[model samples]
Target: MTLEKTPPASADPSPPSASSLAWARRRGSVARFWKEYRTHRAGLLGLAGLAFIALIALFAPLLVGGDVQSVTNAPGTALEKPSGEFPLGTDQFGRSLLGLLIWGARISLTVGLLAAALSVAIGTLVGVIAGHYGGWFATVVMRITDWFLVMPTLVLAIVLATVMSRSIWTVILAIGVTSWPTTARLVRAQTIAVESRPYIERARALGGGHGHIMTRHVLPNVMPLVLAQTTLGISSAILTEATLAFLGLGDPLIISWGGMLQDAREAGAVSSGHWWYLAPPGIAIAFVALAFTLCGRAIEAVLNPKLGVAR
Candidate 1:
């Protein structure tokens, strides 16, 4: 028998490069997530609605013909009913209701996004630390989280907003600070579960550092839950800001859907049967909230199989 010369060890094929492996992993993750997400019809609709709203906000100036002041302060057009000249009619300030609605969408979306990001960041840090350490640190962190949890979020947010300057940043901060406890609890529970996995134990045995393991391993596993919570958080943050604005605590310099509602109420639009003033903003808020709720539910269903089964 002729023996074929064996290839030297140095000539052995190399394993995939680290960068290629990482790219493949990320591509797989995104593909899997999209597969799951596409199965839910309501999620798709909600996503479409959100995208439409974002587009309107992005092109508000162009849509309004770049005359923001004319739309926002047309004193000559005050209280005009919907007509060919102004489709959505003018507010008490003679500003185009359509213009105000478009602009308000921008503010509401911005605050929602910022507040959700801040809340998620704080919650993730607290949860990761508490779950990873699991000692006096965990006890202290959980206690603080519980303290915030027991308080009514809206009431706490209102109080915080009142204490700070009435500005967009103030509203964003107030909502974020008050909104993190639930996320912290969720992340902590998920982290604990992930930490107990055999792979994590193997990592620890291999002398993996806490920061490295947590960031590289634990955080990725917990991110689906974080994403679901973030969608819900955006809706809640928007509603909370609206509540504050309706109560006359919103930034005076900015127009918002809630501020429009407040102005309509103060101007007796509802009592005077001016449906044009009251309907658009209320509908906008309700529509946006419903969209977020639908999307969040769909995400939860995908991430938590139990919920899907129950549904």
Candidate 2:
């Protein structure tokens, strides 16, 4: 007779891992973010407006001509109302309003982009170094950043522009130099968060150099924040340039939108009901500013899924 029958052993069953579940959740989150963004009305409108402005700025010369900056046509044709010859009408110098607006875009957009770029570059470097290696270096860098933060950006920019002379580069440098503090703080925070991740730890364990860890690992993760900051920075920079111009700090030779507005006010165009002189440039400025705000918000949402979902 045989012994009692033996039952077959059961294979081990395991629970789903935390890491795998997290990855799946992340994928689902991304899918939901795209879906939500696609359906967002403000996001689409903002995208379209931004595209329009960018296109116009990019192709200004082709669209109008370099004549925007030149003083041409009749000598006594200052402040002419909208007519067939001058669609947007003539300024105090009889230069084409349409041309001036288009040309102004070049200068305005240039200042905005250059300032933002400089800020981003400087901020990124400062942030990366401070965040990757903490302690005294972080304290020193952050203290400087705090000093800048305490100083009002617009007023400081104005002072610099006035003191250094009213040139495009002067304004750009002033805005750029002072602008990076906020960006630096933002980037530093993002860098600090990213540096704590497991992949970063792995790189550290493998004896990865600081440069490698920062460039290859940290930067990629923090880049989205930098990019979002850039969009908002463009809007801020443009406004700064306009304020400088309105205060007569811009290049006298350059007929920017703000300059046009200033001249219009001085010429009493508003009192004379010559709305044409002020309306176009004002609308253009508002349009561009609104576009930037919208696009920036949209980009921020897209880059930060949690923020997007919250909204």
Candidate 3:
């Protein structure tokens, strides 16, 4: 039998390169996520609405001219009914309701994003540490979380907001600090479940340190839940900010949707039947909240199949 010459070890066919394998995995993950995401029509619509709002906020100066103060606070044109010059009408301050709405989007979205990010970071860190280590650390963390949970989040946020300077950053800090307990509890539960998996045990057996296992293993698994929570948290933060603004606790210098509402109420727009003044801001707030809610629900459904109902 003629034996074919064996290829030298150096000439042996290499398995797929690590980079290629990683690329393939990433592509597959993205595709799978999109597939799941697209199944919800409401989610797609919500995403579209959110994108539209974000774009408007980003290009507010270009769209409405760079003179925000002039457009928003035209002293002579205060409460001008919708006309050719002002489409959404002017508020009690003579500020173009449209300009206020546009700029307000930037403020609301910024506060929501910053607060959600801060809350998620704190929650994830506490949860991972508590879950990974367990024992006394876990007990202490859980107890602290419970105490926060038992306290009314909105009330606590209001108190914090009251104590701090009336600024966007203060609002963000108040909301983030008050909001993290729920996320911590959620993350902690998920972490505990992930920690009990066989892969986690194997990693521990292989002499993986707490940091290594938590970062490399536990975090990846819990990320979907965290992401879903973050999306939902945005809506909550926005609503909370609106409440504060309506209650006259918001920064006096900034114009926001809630501030618009507050101005409208003070101007007796509701009683005076200036539908344009009250309706625009109220509708904007509701629609924005609804959009976030839809997106968050879709994410939750994708991550947790039990929550996926035909909708």
Candidate 4:
């Protein structure tokens, strides 16, 4: 009986499928990126701070009543110092500074994100078209980019804002149009490099059209640069928004850090030593700028490990 019994035939198990392996590789890459990014203390701190600020902005309605912005029924005295009842004190109109700061964060962050997105979109389009379809087209595009690059971004933005209607969208559009040249130059260089790769040539040989190649290959390759540029651009956009507001180009109906500063100046905060009025907004602006810069640096480090090593 023992001799007659034979082991049942077994089939060999197949290895992981190509798609599964690829998915696993992507997951591993993301994990590695997170691990590496966590090592950046400044970046982590900045990210945490940004998260806190964003939460405050997101929960502003729940945190503070709408009456906080009311000039007629203000809950505190104008320029009151920080107190338990009204932490961070009140603005010239007796509005709660804490509430104003939180509300202002929504506007500031919105402008920064929207303006940077618009700038990046325009820049990426210009850069890819210029780089992919080189020669005369590229020359013209580069000339345009150069013209924008050479001009002071602030001046251009100021001019645009001055001509446009005085509104939030106007500020966003002004900043968007004026701040794109730098991103254009960067993306163009990266796109050119990507287009010259052997894979791109192979893709061309495989009957891929310009649109297919650019969308499938070139865009993915240059996305890292675009992402980094966008993060960095947000900080610049926020600063610009503040500048525009301070210069009286911002919407007059909203509470913004820059508007706060402008009010402080108009109220002679400097001479009166209303440090409470000036310091909060100034610090808020600086804090946001530093946070974005730090996060941008970390994203760069993650995308280019060599950069992290160099640092």
User: TM-score, each model?
Assistant: 0.91, 0.83, 0.91, 0.91
Tell me the lDDT of model 3 at 3.
89
lDDT of 2 by residue, 53-156 (tens): 77888899898876667676533388887888888898778877887788788778788889999988898889989999999989998999899999999988
Candidate 3: worst 10 consecutive residues by lDDT? Answer: 67-76
Per-model C-alpha lDDT, please?
A: 0.88, 0.84, 0.87, 0.89
Best by lDDT: 4
lDDT of 1: 0.88
What digit string (tens of lDDT, one per residue) describes model 1 on residues 1-311? 99999877786678899999999999998898789888889988998999999999999878864555454457446677998877889887788888889988989989988999899989988998899989998999999999999999989998998899989999999989988999999999999999999999999999999998899999999999999999998998888888888888889778888888888988899889999999999899989998998899888988886886222
lDDT of 4: 0.89
For residues 163-245, write the lDDT of model 4, one tens digit per residue: 88899999999999998988889899999999989999999999999999989999988998999899999999999999999
Score candidate 1 by TM-score against the native. Answer: 0.91
lDDT of 3 by residue, 154-199 (tens): 8998898888889988889988888898888889899999999999
Error of 3 at 147 (Å): 1.2
Off by over 4 Å in 4: 1-25, 308-311
Q: How close to the true structure is residue 220 of candidate 4, measured as C-alpha lDDT?
A: 85
